[model samples]
Target chain A: EDKVVQSPLSLVVHEGDTVTLNCSYEVTNFRSLLWYKQEKKAPTFLFMLTSSGIEKKSGRLSSILDKKELFSILNITATQTGDSAIYLCAVELFDNNAGNMLTFGGGTRLMVKP
Target chain B: DAGVTQSPTHLIKTRGQHVTLRCSPISGHKSVSWYQQVLGQGPQFIFQYYEKEERGRGNFPDRFSARQFPNYSSELNVNALLLGDSALYLCASSFGAAGVYNSPLHFGNGTRLTVT
Candidate 1:
C-alpha cells in the first residue's frame, strides 16, 4: 500500500528560529512530491520536487527530495508568526488521474511564537 | 482566473441524512478531485474526474459518491451521513487528466460540514 509519513507531528518555536520538517513516502511509480502550507482552510502550494530536480526554494523556505531514501525535508529559515501552519507533504504517482491523486502525510503542525 | 470555487462554506446536518457539496473548477481546467479533511489531519482523496469522466476514486465507502459535469463542475454526495462523516470537503482542479505529472492542483477554500 502507498503511504506518506511525516515526522515531529507538532512543533513550537519562537519567531526567528529555524525549523526543519520531514516527510517520507512509499509508493509505486513515484512521479513527484509536493509541499503545501495550510494556514486555514485551503492549502497553498509551496514546491514540487521530482527525482530529476530534487530541490526547490522560495524566499526563506526551501525543500529537497531524496528519492533514493524515499524522504524529503522542508526548511524554514527565520520563521515568523505568519509561517505558523500545518505543513503537508504529498506524493503523486503515475496514474490515469493526471497525477492529481495524491497520498498525503499526517502533516506537521508548526507554531511560531512572537 | 478565479481559481477553484466551492459552495456552502459551512453546513450542519444530522446523522442518517444526506448532503451534497458542489464545486466549480477554474476555467480551462479539465480535471477535478475531491478530498475529505478531518480536523487536525491532512486531506484524504475521495474522487477524481476529468472531462466528465470518472478517472479515479479513493478508499472511501460507497455511501460517498461524486460526479463531474461536462462543464468540469462536480458534486460530492454523501448518504446516510454518520457522525464520523463530518469534515471539510476540498475541491482541487488541474489542467489535464492522465500523465500530466507536473500539473499542480489548485484548491478551493473548502466546505465545512458538521454532523450532529
Candidate 2:
C-alpha cells in the first residue's frame, strides 16, 4: 500500500516564527510531490517538487523534495496569523496498469497566533 | 473564469437512501476527478474521467460510482449510503488526462453529506 505520513500533526507558534512541516512517503513508481494549503473550503496549490536538492519557493513559503530519503519539507518564514491553516502533502505515483494517482498525507495543522 | 463547481452544497440522507452529487468542470478542462474527505483527514481519490471516459479509479467500493458527460460535467452517485459515508465530496478539474503530469487540479468547495 502507498503511504504518506506527516509529522508534528499540529503546531502553535507566535507571529514571525519560522516553521517547518515534514512529509514522508512510501510508494511505487514515484512521480512528484505536491503541497497544498487548506483554509476553510478548497485547498489551494502551493508547490510541486520533482527533483532533489533544488528548492521551489513562493514568497515566504518554500519546499524541497529529497527523493533519496523519500521525504519532503515545507518551510514558512516569518509567519503571520494568516498563515494558519492545514498543510497537505501528496505524492503522485504512476503505474503502468493504474495510470497516475495521488496519495495524500494526514496534513499538518498550523496555528499562528497574533 | 469559473472554477470547478459542485451542486447541493449540503445534504442529509438515511442509511439506506441514495444520493447524487453533480460537478461542472472549468471551461477547457477535459478531466474531472472525485474525492471524499472526512473531517481532519486528507482527501481520498474516488474516480477520474476524461473525455467522457473512465481513466482511473481509486480503491473505493463499487457502491460509489461516477460518470462524466460530453460537456465534461460529471456526477457521483452513491447507493445504499452508510453512516461512514458522511463526508465532504470534492470535485476537481484539470486540463489534461490522468496520464498527463504536472497538471494541477482545481477544486470546488465540495458537497457535505450527512447520513443518519
Residue B14 lDDT in model 1? Answer: 95
lDDT of 1: 0.89
DockQ scores of all models, one per candidate: 0.52, 0.60
The C-alpha stretches of model 1 lying farther than 4 A from their native spots are A95-100
Q: Return the TM-score for chain B, candidate 1.
A: 0.96
Q: Could you give me the TM-score of model 1 versus the true structure?
A: 0.94
lDDT of 2 by residue, A9-96 (tens): 9999999999999999999988888898989878788987888989999999999999999999999999999999999998878755
Please provide, for model 1 over A19-86, each residue's C-alpha lDDT reduced to its tens digit, 9 standing for 90 to 100: 99999999987878899999998898898888643568899999999988899999999999999999
lDDT, residue A16, candidate 2: 95
Clashing pairs in 2: none
Docking class of 1: medium
- For residues B15-54, what per-residue lDDT tens digits would candidate 1 score against the true structure? 9999999999989999999999999889999998988988
**Residue B100 miss distance in model 1 (angstroms):** 3.4
Pairs that collide, model 1: A98-B98
Report the lDDT of model 2 for residue A44. 81
True contacts kept of each: 0.47, 0.48
